[model samples]
Target: MADSYMDFTSPNTQFTYTLSDNPFFQKDAQNVINTLSINQLNTLGNVSLLDIFLSKDNVVEPHIHQNATELVYCITGGAVVSLINPYTKELLNFTIAPGQVANVPQGWWHYEVANQDNTHLLAIFDAPVPEVIFGSDILRLTPANVLAHSYCLDEAKVKDTLAPITDTVIIGPPASCSKQHPNGMPMQQMMNHGGMNMAQMAPGSYQQAIQNQTYHYPYRPISGESESYNAPLDHPFHPIPFLYRRWD
Candidate 1:
């Protein structure tokens, strides 16, 4: 009988990994991700993973995976997974605890936030190499005039806000940020200035909010079309389009 482990001619076909062997990104010594992809595991063909570790209120910055879908499983602590569905153009959010999971479709913009200390989540992808576009790059690289004209934003403010993002920040709220939140406000306040009142809500209420909250916006065209043909006049797209809550 031939020994099952005796094939060594191709020394590069690795079958195991120490995920922490490489650091994907880290911020303020509080949040970090150890990414494993085709670059690290030559034998990997259809899948990869990110070992995410985040402290309380820490966030994995908004990003898009152009090549694959992501399945996130929580191993410890709690977190909120948020994504924007481009098709429906609504922002969706989910809160997950240990033993729960969330899925983000390919090419959708998404982010994750840790709700408790020592949060650990595994982000699995369907492609061997999941190509990513971080929001930091988009905010920093685009010409200010283009953004100002398209979004009707102030060019100077756009440039000033994004000037500090010189590097790709996978974990965000850079350590140098000085906009302090007085008192113990909910972490969502840090994400948006008009914070949701989550500090006094029960966990169940929070989950309900995740399940029911939907962002509604008026439809506007980007091209020469008058209105979207398949959409209704009042609310053209689906209201609650993209979020999937796996468990409680």
Candidate 2:
């Protein structure tokens, strides 16, 4: 019988799809990623997923999925999913272990850092293909002078530092880098590290900052600002849109 309701492709003819066969992207030896989407399974074109494997301290660099909301499930070990809430203007960090999940709204800047070795995660997306903007790309693509002027940063320093980021860093802080913080954490934390449940913040403090447009964390307050705060709000490490040219 010809079914008018759907295409006549036979599901039985299509062999079982394996995640291992789909290679989306990867980093060094410590990080591996597998992707699944409409490209592989036509039946589930509206949804997509990423299988990520990382060693201790490895990071899925800060980026934004312009097209889809991501739901990340921790399959093994531990990790910290960090993102900013646009509505509250509050930085949120969730510690995720096996059986835990974290969600990142579409177009939000976010990143994941593995807290332990053999960390595995599955990131499911609402779209078939997720368009992303990596923080490293934004930093490298934008002219140093533009960034220096916009954020009042020194031009020379910006150029010298970002010169190394020539490509989209899928996973970062390579295992070879020996840099460490005084507390024994890797240098990854140097880029706006946030903690879960900021207890030191007084009640209504974040709300007030959101109202006044005076939330200052990593950067000094703009001139004429008396109230200053030093919270996890300093996440310039995340990707932000920068239009270089207009498409006609």
Candidate 3:
């Protein structure tokens, strides 16, 4: 258990907090993230969570939570969580539906893509506050000359390609982005042109590829079972045992 130096005997101690009041990132109402941490609820130990809502083809940009491991639980609809294993340098993808979860080890580069509309995921972390390093920030902040020299690419092209990324993109492609694909081809059309390996494609293309149903995921479901499961929207939130039970 995480030690807390709070004065529990004090009347100022807070026992309840509304997570929605604390917004982490909002990419419009449909694609928004609400956060909860020890800062918001002083009684909390070493735990935090992000309530994520995403629409179809929406992505939670690739990032790393350096301080804690994240367990993404699917509450409604479905999504694909992809992570790159540092040890093996392999990209692993997991398709999670309602009642399922995908875990990302601490410091691992990973991202999530909503496969269906009204997808809701709860990202729980083992730390009081989750610190992240987003891919967009790295790409945008890195000097174009440095990247070009390191990758043996054209400096001008690198600058042009990354110029549009003005800020941290938590959910993307940014709302202002007009082009969905690089070559002016729709994502589905590109996938239909020729089946390709998702691992070989750039990180930005993963969401579109997965949405088009072209990328093959590693895990396979039981033959008799359905490929995907959708939770009813009438009851959006599930009951959490810890919330109702007294720890004492």
RMSD of each: 13.2, 13.6, 16.3
Each prediction's whole-model lDDT (CA): 0.66, 0.65, 0.69
Candidate 3 yields a Cα-based lDDT of 0.69
TM-score, candidate number 3: 0.73
Candidate 3 residue spans exceeding 4 A from truth: 178-248
Per-residue lDDT over 1-248 for candidate 1, one digit per residue giving the tens place of the 0 to 100 score: 22243344687667788888877666645577788876787666677888899987777878887778999999999888899889898888888999999999998999998888899999999876666766755664456666777899887766655554554556655554322344566565545433334344343343343233222223322233543344331132322122111100
Please list the residue runs of candidate 1 whose C-alpha ends up more than 4 Å from where it truly belongs after superposition: 1-11, 178-184, 189-248
Name model 2 segments beyond 4 Å from true.
1-15, 187-248
Question: In terms of TM-score, which candidate is stronger, 2 or 3?
Answer: 3
A best-first ranking of the candidates according to their lDDT comes to 3, 1, 2
TM-score of model number 1: 0.70
In model 3, which residue pairs have backbone atoms overlapping below 3 Å?
Answer: none
- In candidate 1, how many Å is residue 12 off? 3.6
> How far is 227's C-alpha from truth in model 3 (Å)?
48
lDDT of 2 by residue, 1-248 (tens): 22233353766333347987886555555588888776676556467788899887778878888778999999998888989888999878888999999999998989998888899999999886666666756776567777887999998877655555554556765333333544554544544466322223344342343233311112122233433334222234422333121000
Position 248, candidate 1: lDDT: 5
Indicate which candidate wins on TM-score.
Answer: 3
